[model samples]
Target: MILITGAAGNLGSAIINSLLKKVPANQLAAFVRSEQKAEQLKKLGLNIRIGDYNDIASLDNAMKGIEKVLLISGLSMERLKEHTNVVDAAKRAGVKQIVYTGVTMKDAAVSPLKVLMESHFQTENYIKASGIPYTFLRNTLYAEVIPFYIGDQALNTGIHYPAGAGRVPYVYRPDLADATAVVLTNKGHENKTYQLTGDQLYSFTDVAGMLSEVSGKHIAYTDVDPVAFEKHMKEIGVPEIGIMISTGFAAAIKQGDFEVVTADLEKLLGRKPTPVKQYLKAHYVG
Candidate 1:
């Protein structure tokens, strides 16, 4: 049986939906924060287990009779500890394999993405040290989340960002989820790390063009100074952590941290992934 943690999350839900087409419902389980959070998955006749990565006992219970686990990365200072708890529980539960959703920062050893996502590196180390058969899905930035970073403020004030003309191969969350399901169901993935990225590379200017074309508005991109961007984030009442991530991520992009192209994603879906223009229209426009 395969179990997915953080089951209510977007990526987790997509993975579950994709797996349902191949794996039987009886063999699928969802580990969520609570029964209330899992009602929809339960309605689909999936086995639901209430567990938190912070709680080892809960994770142990959730992992019962589960052979493979998809440990979706967490989002906080406690991420590393949380992942370690899940790995330890899975080991005790006799899980045969673990599929980890990790990050892909180009030249991680010397990038701002590395500094911001230190937990991912630690978690990867812990999982490897645990001696469990593992598949690491080194996913790039999610294009679906571009809304959060780009913001509607960009529409009114034009696109103001610290990133220069560097490009990012942003992968769709659903596509990564679909790929994760395939890895979980198939064999020969143990100890493998797949660098998954979109087929196309787009810069912030490219994104501005996409928004302009789709919304029929004259949107523009301005390359702001990093200090000015940080000040702007503060002026907009962004929290300290949010401000750091925003500025650092933009800096990483400017330094060509995410400008990677790979055929692995196409191999995962057996088709060309959707284009940014199409995604922009479908998401931002009518």
Candidate 2:
């Protein structure tokens, strides 16, 4: 059986749906925290396993007999103890291949997400030590996440974030999901690290231009200092931790760390990844 944790979440659901097209639903097991979520997934014709990372025994039972497992990263910012439970349970369950969805902050020396990198590296270490073959899909920023920051507000006020007009190497989640499904089903992808991202580089100014063209609304891009950007986020009541993460990532983008594209994702999926503007038109315009 192939187990997918966080099966109720957006990324997990996308991955599960993609995998279902290739593998039988019964051959796929979904591990979620809540009974409501389990019921929902069951209605979709999935094998349900009730488990939570907080409860190691539940995780252990849920993972038993699973050949390949996808450990979708959790959302709990300050509380990462749950990730530990998953690593231990997967270890004991003797899972054959483990695929992890991780952030693209791989350069430990110059990474903006210094604090967040530790958890991903720790998980990577655990997978390496587990005696199970592993694949790390080191994902870039989501394309959809951009609209949440620059969308309707730009439509109304004509101005979006002023993070020095940096370029973002946004990755489409559905594309990432497709690439991941290939690894889960196909062989010879073990112990590989894939930095998945979009086919093109897009700056914030380019984003504004795309939105304006699509929506027929005039939008302007402003360059704001990092300090001022953080202050703006705070004045708008953005959580401190989230602000730090956003600011650090924005700084990194401005420095051109995310502009490079790799063929690893396309080679795995047998197709090209989605472009940023097209994704925005599909997601935001309609």
Which candidate has the top score in TM-score?
A: 1
Query: Once superposed on the true structure, which residue ranges of model 1 sit more than 4 Å away at CA?
Result: none
Judge candidate 1 at residue 113 and give its lDDT: 69
* Model 1 local distance difference test score: 0.87
TM-scores for all predictions:
0.95, 0.91
Model 1 C-alpha lDDT per residue in residues 39-65, reported as the tens digit of each score: 999998899999798887899899899
**What's the true lDDT of residue 30 in model 1?**
94
lDDT of each residue in 24-46, candidate 2, tens digit only: 88899999988898887898788
lDDT (Cα atoms) of all candidates against the true structure: 0.87, 0.79
Superposed Cα RMSD, model 1 = 1.5
